[model samples]
Target: MAKAMTIPDYHPYQQAHLNKPQLQFSDIAPLIEHYQVQPWLTVTELGRSVKQQPIYQLQLGQGDKRILAWSQMHGDESTATAALFDLLNYLQAPEQAAWREQLFAEITLYIIPMLNPDGAAKHSRVNAQGIDINRDALALQSPEGQLLMAAAKQIKPHFAFNLHDQNRFHAAGPYPNPATISLLAPAYNAEREINASRRAAMQLIAHVQPWLEQQIPQHIGRYADDWSARSFGDTFAAMGISTVLVESGAYRGDDNRQMARWLNFQLYVAWLAAIASDSYQQADVALYNAIPFNRSGGMKDVLLQGLTVSIGDTTATVDLAINLALTGDRRARIDELGDLSLFSAFHQFSVQGLAFKAGQAYPLNTALSLDTEAHLALLQQGYTHFSGDKALLQASSRLPVLLNPLRPTQGSPQLWQGATFLLVNTQGKVVQAVLNGQLISVPSGVIHNPLGT
Candidate 1:
């Protein structure tokens, strides 16, 4: 069993141990204190979260090129929150202070350190009212969204930093590849047209890309510039704010998202350099197209063979897949797999394996490598814990491929329709209850006795 973690009370060089330590809300209090003491810093309480926690804006530099950056709008995604603080600390170092001063001097900065304080406190993506603040850009119904809007209106920052995080399944370049950092210079509206907003955002991304690529080459990505009404990035760009969508995406085995925090600091530093210099504006915006879309390949935790089981009385069979333990407090649908996040007392029934039907769009060619004896031994040991009404399990050496949320949930489960299982009943016929849907595997001690008999 993984030990229950006890994060340190405080970390001097917070950025250095982001991945190692479990961060908490209390950890940020000292940072606020530090910022308060800085002569150049101007911390503002723009508004409050639904939970009534103060939302702060940290402004630095007094230049014409006003830039705005925010983090943790999705409360559970706190890597950027850590990174922003780290960036501020890095600027305090004597060696980097000169360059940092010049950058800040030329660019007035607006930073909302934690946009969704309520969500951050609870470690959830949604605000206190359970509304996804990202999708509330237009509605502005939630206090969190309203506060962000109010801040934006007040600052009128020329360039906006729309920061968030993504899942582990996202590959940097494409299938079988991992992108340590993914960036999106989001396009305005539905057309995906290259306007001033996108160009400005893309120029900044392009400037930062070279530096990031040099550090973690072939692992930086350009996000899909898709348009959505409630999307803050799209709306900000539509309002001509020149928004750059910074997605702190997946890194291997870093479930707590510390690697993301480190990369974010690097990106922020590079971003400051870009903003300060204005060097990338002349570069071709077409460079943004060269980045590959992240693919959901080689990211699953478990794969299974054919699994047939019964849901109540109806027999449902499919190739079962499971992604190992994912740690988060909120509920998010497995859009690709079409499974509801079901919770049980001992274990949660969230399927991880990519479900696909034969001759369908399921993953092909890729295989899993498992020792038969060891696998069987593990299964045998696990079997002792199987005491449910119906169970179907199969193991395979294939990566999971989830269907995108574009499909219906019913169509999603169709991929797993060939699984086999054994049924158990707590009634009189213990032995006979172990039977397949087609009356196969009849235990010898079992007798088919009618209720009347």
Candidate 2:
């Protein structure tokens, strides 16, 4: 069916620089068709979404050890999908044909590239049925889940990969944003008993550890191994399949996830090569804990400081916090605009003024204790206190708060005054909707900007 191209020792980064694009489901179809070559290499439609879009499966290799890998379980998670595509392209290359040929000669590979095609197109987390496919692995309520489960049952691969994209909020310790990336050799059952299958999975992760560490050391982490009945990797591991969960998450500086994308491809290539080598007799599990813990670097896109706003009947100097979606440029992308919510918890601010000294974090739970010296510090930093009565709240209940009476809004998309409900292109500087109570500026440059203009 699909013709294999010739590629040399293909470097994943080089290929990514050439193939990185905001890919859609349609763009992968031709490539899929091109790879459907040979009697052993077969392609089939696993099922269709509610929208009637076909969910395709490509199978290569027919050996004793089969690896079942799926991508785009969350529609918005596309880094794994891109890595899978690049792997295919590399496998088809003239120089890399031997690797494909040798691997297929012994092992069978079943790939469902973009399991949630509908979600991939819409770039949402849930599938067409509004159910998370990962959670549905055990429930098997949605057709997508059923399709994947049925395929797993029929093929019963020795190993599996649950690929996804996590948020940028996760840090490599407690101070860095853009969690370099994390992996999980999911535990099975209530006790998290490590059986042969779990061991197999760990070996795989251990194998990729060297390559990943060399590329991005002091990053990479082991996800919490708590077992969840609803989670796919957990369920699969419980059922005796060694499922390795690969999370393609955020990277520092490169918000569009381009850096993560390239790392993901390299990781996958190293993983496949390791699997083919069958060298698992000497995997060191102790290295798992050595993976650095992600840190949170205090970053705020828009800081409004030292403004006397009326809270109920009292006028006090209030600070406004706006958390932005980090994408594209490190400064501020147009789409990273979000509503400023009221936060009543102790927030660690860069703190250079406003009743508070530098490095001082205040609990917004109580009334303001204004200090002119602190206020001057904020003003010097070009910090303008928020204007308007609407306060958007993003504080979680678990966060520490000194006072509770001044608590702000919570949950995703909480709205606040002077906060833009809609993100607009401020030419190049981040602009907001309802600016000064009216639409301001206009969009220019990149159209359909994925990293938010």
Candidate 3:
């Protein structure tokens, strides 16, 4: 099946407008306007979110072999949602009509582009009620969860695709490579027995394994099949649906997740073609089983190795791992500190013969002159933190500007503390400054804050 399958190039079908991070409903609203007029497609409101946001379902094709797929269940996971719109555009392309015609004639798709619009608005994981709709599958407490259940029973799809995005700080295996895509044939029972429906789903993933490797080598992984009773994929599998869980993980430099989005589009087309053509039956389940389980906390944003940190009067050389929080409180925290030899980061620095020190605060005398002689001088003088007039601070400096007075904990870099301090060398020279998890080179004078906040 690997040799026989052909992966579609995602460039032609890539929705240019939806190529962004944390995509809200407003971003894709204009592109979906034409679906209303398209004769082949049917768009209907599934239900409304807790905040009264309308949830939409797009029905494509008129075949008995049904496939149900949805995205943005956990709102921050917008990569698959964008790719779903791309899939819609791909189905309408005149150039691919030949294979697409067969696909449409064989399999019908009920796609819910955004399930939790209220959560999507705020780039949150849960709904407006602070409830995780995915976990609420059995409870049916969230309106979003109820709508999904209704859609499943109404469509009774032969196959279901549970689309989601996993954290970037995870490894494909023990290797340093990040898991770009995690596939799963969700287990229906507590024993995790592979039934006929699960067998087909496993084969489908196996059929696409080679193609995924061609695109993202050593980056493919398998999500743990823990038989999550409350999860939609597992529940659907228990209901005799061949449920496939495609978790869009992180690509090394693709911070916006466009790479993952493109891969999702390719997999959808290829897998659908396989299912439509019945090519997945020939695929070996061992290929799917061979995929490495995703290992969490495998990576961090920055790692400062061999740094001398002072705890009271005792100084010890250890490694510090820093990660930038993505959602609610978007601050860089010292996730782990002390002999983090097993972990890796996008940016790693060896601060040998250097001691960590808390930076002093300097009052703003005038407007913040950034990257100027005055700025460099201030850094040399050990003024890493700043507190001053609000208007002057609004100009934006590389350093973290303190609105309120500094806390006692802010003085020293502690475990799970904020990453804001100075790295001083033997001569007491401040050679580096870490602000908001970003490493700054003092000598090169390249100290710009990556997080604008």
On lDDT, the candidate that comes out on top is 3
Report clashes for each candidate as comma-separated counts.
Answer: 21, 48, 0
- Model 3, range 170-231, lDDT digits (tens) per residue? 88877777788989999999999988999999999998887787778888888888978888
> Residue by residue across 102-200, what tens digits does model 2's lDDT show?
877767888898888888777688888899999998779988888889989999988898988876555555433445678888989889878998988
Residue-by-residue lDDT tens digits, candidate 1, 68-170:
8988898878778888888777667665566667877789888888788788777788989999999999999999889888888888888999888776656
Off by over 4 Å in 3: 1-9, 311-313, 365-370, 392-411, 447-453
Q: Which scores better on lDDT, 1 or 3?
A: 3
Candidate 2 backbone overlaps, count: 48
Model 2, global lDDT? 0.59
Best by TM-score: 3
